[model samples]
Target: MQLVTWNTQWCCGLDGVVSPQRIVQHARALADFDVLCLQEIAVHYPALEGNAGHDQVALLRALLPGYQVFFGAAVDEWTPDGQRQRFGNLIATRLPVLQLQHHPLPYPADAGVRSMPRMCTVATVRDPGLGAVRVMTTHLEFYSKRQRMAQARALRVLHAQACAHAVAPPEASGDGSPFQSKAHTPHAVLCGDFNFEPHEPEHAAICAPAGADDSEGAPLGMRLWDSWRLLHAAAPQPPTFRLYDRRYGPEPGSCDFVFVSDSLKGRVQRFVVDAATQASDHQPVAVSIA
Candidate 1:
């Protein structure tokens, strides 16, 4: 399974911020991903942006056929110029999307920024080639620790749901929910800008540290594992963010990543955070898992 995660900056790069064609061109060149998760996709609904009021999500779906696309709007607002726009993350999958769900994180009062809601989107896929997998995309609050903690709890709750749903009976359950009974914990691939490092508490709640050596030199920790660290191993320069913007991290940078569950870590044969890419402010992370 090939998966990708990128913050398109609403496809605002190179020439202009609202160039839809640039978004298509650059993202297509990024990778041929089976499952793609994008953040900051500027989709202006009710009133369109650019020429024909082209919906960014529609354009991407048109570009990549056969694959399924799902959008979760985090913030909806009206522009001063009198157009209403929605900015949020996107989840597109080639595998059969059996179920789709979204959750909005709660923001605190002291945070001061209650303008937009942080959202998480998940897609449970039934693939003919690779069995079944769940892919999720989300953007956490960048400024508030309180909001982020709340966001983390929201994600954990959603993660637990995905795990439980993966094994649900294919036939409708007693409550009318449909899921397969024999399914397992569901191979999940979480992609996005977590805004926290591997050792950070936020990271711990998401993809728990895995594949690292313990005191007994054994590979053990929690449930989820960092796919980036697993793929790169001990490469000296693994900076993803500093590849374009030089002033983001302290000693160079590397913030973007693709994290997977421990059960699927070995399935990942390739993982690359595109540092040299000029399409967006942050580099894109691509991972191939079997």
Candidate 2:
């Protein structure tokens, strides 16, 4: 299966043009992806540069027919005119979805730092090669380190919780009820614009080993491994953000990453970053599993 993750600056390119069609065209040019994960999707937010308050989710859905598009709005609020504005992440996949969850991440207060509510969208889909696998896409707090750390730790806890459930599933309900059986899998692929460099503590926290915090004592073994490292070995991950556009920073480095759980590490076949694209401020990262 081929999956690609990108932070489409609301589908606005470096030329100050907002076009969802361009974003879709660039993604397809990179690879024939079965799943596409996007961050910073805007809806009803015309204030964004070059954005016309277009419903990005609707546009993406219309553009990619036959693909299931799921959106999780982290910053959902109302304008003075009562128009609802949503900004967050989206996932488009052709795989058969078994279950889906929109998890609102921690948004602790940080004085004098600009930040927005964040969330992670989790979808358990049936892959042709990997059986049931969770594809989680998210965008974390950018300007605040405290909130980002908290959010990172929270992600580890959530992964642990899901792994525990996969080990010991809930009671099966024969009746057609809410407590019926659901697709559960420890195998997961967590990808998105993490907004933290590889050397940062937030990155290490997610890759850290599960310890006492896991009350269920689920033997998940080690935590997530960067898919790039799994295949690239000693090579550093190519820059994903600020390569084409240097307004964010002078030095180019990667803030976006694709991390796979230990169970799926061996299945990671290819990991590549499209560094040549200027479709957005960030480059698209693709990973293939077989």
Candidate 3:
């Protein structure tokens, strides 16, 4: 399966134009993705640069027909016009979605640092070859180091929780209720704009194992492995941000990445960063697993 993750910056390109259609076009040009994960999608928030309070989730849904779209709003509020405005991550997939979940990451208050609530959207999809696979996408806190670390820890906890569920699934009623059994695989792909460079401790924290106790004889749950490292062990990671847009600072480096559980490490066929697209301030990262 082919999956792509990108932070659209609300679809505003380097030219300062916010167009959802343009974002879709750029993504399609990258690859024929089975799943597309996006972060920083805004809805009814005109304060963003080049954004006019457009419903990005709706626009993307309309653009990609037959794709199941799931939006996890970390910042949800009502607009002056009484419309519900949301800002967060979105996952759209052409594969069959069996289950969906929105997990709000830890957001501890930090004084004098601009930060916002963040979330990860998890979807269990039926891949034609992989069968059941859990895919999750998230955008970590950018300004506050403490908050980002907490959020990273929370992601590890969530992964462990999902594994526990998979190992001991709940009993299902056979009374023909709508609550039927569904596929829940321990194998997961966590991808998104991590907001931390490879040199940062937060990156290592996320990839760290839950604990020795948690993996006592389980062949299912395992620590996440960096997809880039799995494929390019000797090469430096390609820059995924600050390549051309240096408004924040100079020096190009990667903050976006695709990480897979150890179980799926060998299945990782390709990992790439689309450095050519200026569709957003951040570049798109694609991963192919077979």
Candidate 4:
């Protein structure tokens, strides 16, 4: 299975043009992805840089036929025209979606710092090579360090929760009830714009083992292995943001990543970053798993 993750910046390219079609085209040029995870997708929010309030979810769904689109809006509000405006993460999968969930990450209020609510979109899909697997994409708080750390902790908690549920799923009805059993696998691929540099403490926090108290007796929490490190070892990670656009700062670094559960470590075949695409301020990272 091939998976790609990118922060679209609402589809605004380096030329200051916001085109969902171009974003799709650029990602397709990178790889024939079985799953695509996009962050910073806006809906009916024309105020964003170069955005014209287009429903990016619908546009992406239309562009990628036969894919199931799942959106998790971290910032949801009603515009002056009574239309809904949402901004958050998106997951598009060609695989069969067995279950879908939206998890709102920790967003402790910090009046001094400007930050928005963050969320992770989780989907359990049936992959031809890996069978049932959990996939999640998220965008963490950018301006608030405290919030970002909290959000990272929340992600670890979520992973442990999923594993617990997978081990002891709820009882199902014998009759053809609406509440049928769905596939839930401990193996997962967590990818997205983490909003923190690869060397930051938040990155290490994410990879740290969960405490025994946090796991609820389901063994030690599953460790998430960085796909890049597993494949490249001592090599320095390529820049994924601020490569050309320096709106936030001049220094370029990698803030986007793809992490697979320890169970799926050996299955990680390849990891590549499309550094040439200017379709968005951030580059796309693709991973091939067997």
Candidate 5:
């Protein structure tokens, strides 16, 4: 299975153009991805640089004909004109989707830092190679360290709960109601802009061992393994943020990541980053699992 993740900066490229067409074209050029996970998708936010209040989800759906697009809006608010505005993450895939869940992450009160609500979009899809696996994409709070840490820990808890569910699935039910049984698997691919560096505590919080001190007698949970580290053991991780655009910081840092569960770590065949693309401030990352 081929998966690609990117922070599209609301489809605003470095050239001061907000074009979903270019984002789709460039992503297609990067790889023949079965699933594409994206962050910072905007809807009705004309105030953003170069954005004209376009519904990016609709635009992306029109562009990707065979794929299903799922969006989770972290910031959903009303404008004075009564139109709704949304900004958050999105996932598009050609694979068969079994179930979907949108989780609102913890947004703690940070007195002096500017922050926004955050969320994670989870899609359980049937991959031809990996079968039923969850693909989760999220963008954490960037400006607040306390909020970021809380969000990261919340993500780990969510993963562990899903893993526990997979280990002990509910009883089979085909009543054609909401309780109907769906495809369940522990295998997962979590990717997005974490807004924290590799050495940061938030990163450690995410990749930390699961179920180390479980109060409940649930099965031992599986910890996530960084895909880049699995493939590139010694070399430093390539910068995925602020490589060409130095407005954020003078030094480029690797903030975006794609992590897989321990079960899928051995299946990680390839990991690649498109460092040459100026489609967005952040670079696009792709991974292949066999």
Candidate 6:
């Protein structure tokens, strides 16, 4: 199934289509995606230059008729008194959603240090061909490295639990299959702005198998694997962040990523970083796996 993960920057761009409309346009552009994971999807925040923003979930549901919508709101508050300012990650899928979990990531050691709170939303998508699989999306902490590391660790834990639950026991299926031996695990696609460069030391732990010890030498329970490396089997040399647009040249790569379990590496058909697009400060990323 085709899948896309993009950070639209609340759809504030030169197109003037507005956040809701941009979500629609972008979804339409990606035509046949089985799953679409989005970050920075604002509901009440207006564009940087256009009309007042509309409900992103409602608008996108219209754009993607066959897909079911799931949103994880990171913030729900008003600028002053009554206005609502809600924004967070979103998951749209054509696959049947068996269940979903939205939880806050781990915070840094120094709680008082101050940083933006982040969240990771996990969704169980049912594939008739492959049964059920986990699809997750999250925007990592931007300012604090400690927080990001902790968040990454927490994400792994959550992913392992969700994945464990997704598998249907042979007896539960009523097929009367005697033994329930799991020889191979299914796939889990984790996408979003990790806020860390590719191959960064902090991510070494996240990229490791579930329950492996981290860089700190402490035991980590849930091992979250990297789908990119699973598919590529290697990290691309140099950085993958900022891009020189129509105005500038090659800048630096910032935050963006797609990770999956090691077993499904060969399934990745292609991985593209569309940083040249003017849709937002960050470019869109698409990964097609069989």
Per-residue lDDT tens digits for candidate 3, residues 1-290, read 99999999999999989999998888888889999999999999888889648889999999999898999999999967799888999999999998898999998989999988999999999999988889999999988999999998778777767766677777865676667776757789999999899888998887887554454333344678889999998588999989999987788988998988766889999887889989899999888999
The segments of candidate 6 whose C-alpha lies over 4 angstroms from its true place after superposition are 14-17, 27-31, 47-52, 109-114, 163-186, 213-223, 235-240, 244-250
Model 5 C-alpha lDDT per residue in residues 1-290, reported as the tens digit of each score:
89999999999999999998999998999999999999999999999999659899999999999999999999999999899999999999999999999999998899989999999999999998788989999999889999999999888888887888888889999999998997778898999999998888898898888886483223665788889989988688999998999998999999889999978999999999999999999999999987
* TM-score of each candidate structure, all chains considered together: 0.78, 0.97, 0.94, 0.95, 0.97, 0.79
TM-score of 6: 0.79
Instruction: Give lDDT tens digits, candidate 1, residues 216-265.
Output: 22134424667767776656426655465555555555556676765677
CA lDDT, every model vs. true structure = 0.67, 0.89, 0.87, 0.88, 0.91, 0.69
Residue 242 alpha-carbon offset, candidate 4, angstroms: 0.5
Stretches > 4 Å off in candidate 1: 14-17, 45-54, 78-83, 113-115, 165-185, 209-222, 234-237, 246-252
**On lDDT, who's better, 1 or 5?**
5
Q: Over the full model, what C-alpha lDDT does candidate 2 score relative to the true structure?
A: 0.89
Superposition error at 145 for model 6 (Å) = 1.5
In model 4, which runs have C-alpha deviations exceeding 4 angstroms?
Answer: 174-179, 215-217
Q: In model 6, where is the ten-residue run with the lowest total lDDT?
A: 213-222
| Residue lDDT tens for model 2, 1-290 | 89999999999889888988988988888879999999999999999988749899999999999899999999999999899999999999999999999999999889999998999999899998899999999999989999999999888777877887788899877687888898878899999999999899999998887654656355748478889888988688999988978898899999999989878999999888898888889999988988
Single out the weakest 10-residue window by summed lDDT for candidate 5: 212-221
| Shift of residue 193 alpha carbon in model 2, Å | 0.3
Worst 10 residues of 3 by lDDT: 212-221
lDDT, candidate 4, 1-290, per-residue tens: 89999999999998989999998998998889999999999898888778658899999899999898999999999967799889999999999988898999999989889998999999999998788899999999889999999998788778777777677787865566767776757889999999898788888878877545544334575767789999999697899999989988888899999988877989999889998999899999999999
Candidate 6 global CA lDDT score:
0.69
